[model samples]
Target: MTETTENKDLVQEENVVTEETVEEQAELTVEEQYEAQIAELQAKLDDEENRHLRLRADFDNLRRRQQLDREAAEKYRAQSLLTDLLPVLDNFERALQVETTSEETASIVKGIEMVYRSLIEATEREGLQVIQAEGQPFDPNVHQAVMQEQDSEKEAGTVVRELQKGYLLKDRVLRPSMVSVNE
Candidate 1:
């Protein structure tokens, strides 16, 4: 009877130890699951933050590009009107070249000259400038070589004569001067 009682006590102690070990394993598993979930949530949050930063940078670049475009448009606002009036200005120049024989013709010529001067003044105020080509070095940017000539008096690559005038609006070339270059 003493042996039987000792055996029963030992079995009870073993059962308690097994239960405690199983409970400890269960708690450990639950903690591991929570840690994994926290890691996953942290990764997702970091990804979202990166995406937001990229979107903000792109938006800022777009806004800057649009502002530059607006400023350029404003700067060249009168370009089209000035371009359209260039042919009329050419006609006025041609009309002024006519030789007047009589007093009546001279008066008409003087009136045309006054009108031409006014037109030139108005165009100048709007940033129109005549490009000087004659006796200067030939430049493809502001002068177009319509014909090349061999001249003993001028240096090679110099502009011998300007056939038609060129105009500029601010720093932009409206038309290149038609010129003869010495070669």
Candidate 2:
């Protein structure tokens, strides 16, 4: 072969090799771009999933708290009205203590006693309970010591007398017992 023809043949081969390399490089670039886009989309999907889980948990907690609050409200629904009626009960008890002078007075007292008993029964049914104070041990949670007296017959810290009656509504104290404690 002549030198020019040989040179032309070499140049054609190099051009073919360069064209294949350029095509391979373009395909690799497109593949790499697709991989990067897929990775970005996956990350976004994962973040959204985590956020949704947190929001669901928050809603569940809120719903549980609200249910507990509603139950507590229902349990204490009549507390206010019961507290207001305590004074009326006390007056009824005081009225029943009056001395009767004649048959008419005795009948009136007996009638008052019947009405008082009815009131007591109704209140007891609604969870009203009398706190026992006299001769019992004084407790700060259920009894208020208004007077302290030195009493040798009673043990120290014992309730000597109940000045004013205390009452309970279920497990809660409506009024603490006003008592005189032995020192």
Candidate 3:
């Protein structure tokens, strides 16, 4: 190619397009072109920022939902085990309601004792424990006074007998101990 002044000017013209050519390409004036490009870039940046915010929000929602589901699962996991134990409690109630045959009464009583011991032990394993009330000072937080009696043997306001053993489940009380207090 010859190094001509006209050729160089043509190259320069191609590099730096005229205002009329630019207006024709985008169908806008020079000022409008600058404004449109800026607006377009701003819109794209806004869309990208909004998309990132939406994704972060989705992830946070998923984490919260998962935590709630885990809590629900833990709450119901012991339901079946507790249901199975209902029949044993029923049997105990029945045994207390009526006397047994003389022939089998001793064995039945022994069986009941064994069953009660094992049930209590099992409950302890599951975080259940009996509250101490006999011969101790009366405390309303853990002990429920069923009857008050005058006794010379025990100090006044001391528990003489336990009517029904109270139980604790974990750190919370499942039942308050029923007791007779010497007044």
Q: Each model's TM-score, in the order given?
A: 0.85, 0.80, 0.48
**Of models 2 and 3, which has the larger TM-score?**
2
Candidate 2 lDDT over residue span 1-183, tens digit each: 689998999999999999999999999999999999999999999999999999999999999999999977776666788899889988888888888899998999899999989988988887889999999999999999999999999899999999889999888899999999999
lDDT of 1 by residue, 1-183 (tens): 889999999999999998999999999999999999999999999999999999999999999999999988887788899889888899999999999999999999999999999989988888899999999999999999999999999999999999999999999999999999999
Deviation in Å, model 2, residue 42 alpha carbon: 2.7
Q: Runs in model 1 with CA error above 4 Å?
A: 1-17
State how far residue 147 of model 2 sits from its true place (Å): 1.7
Candidate 3 off by > 4 Å:
1-103
lDDT for model 1? 0.94
RMSD of each: 2.3, 2.7, 9.3
Clashing pairs in 2: none
Please, what is the whole-model Cα lDDT of each candidate in the order they appear?
0.94, 0.92, 0.78
Which consecutive 10 residues in model 3 have the weakest lDDT in total? 75-84
Sort the predicted structures by lDDT, highest score first.
1, 2, 3
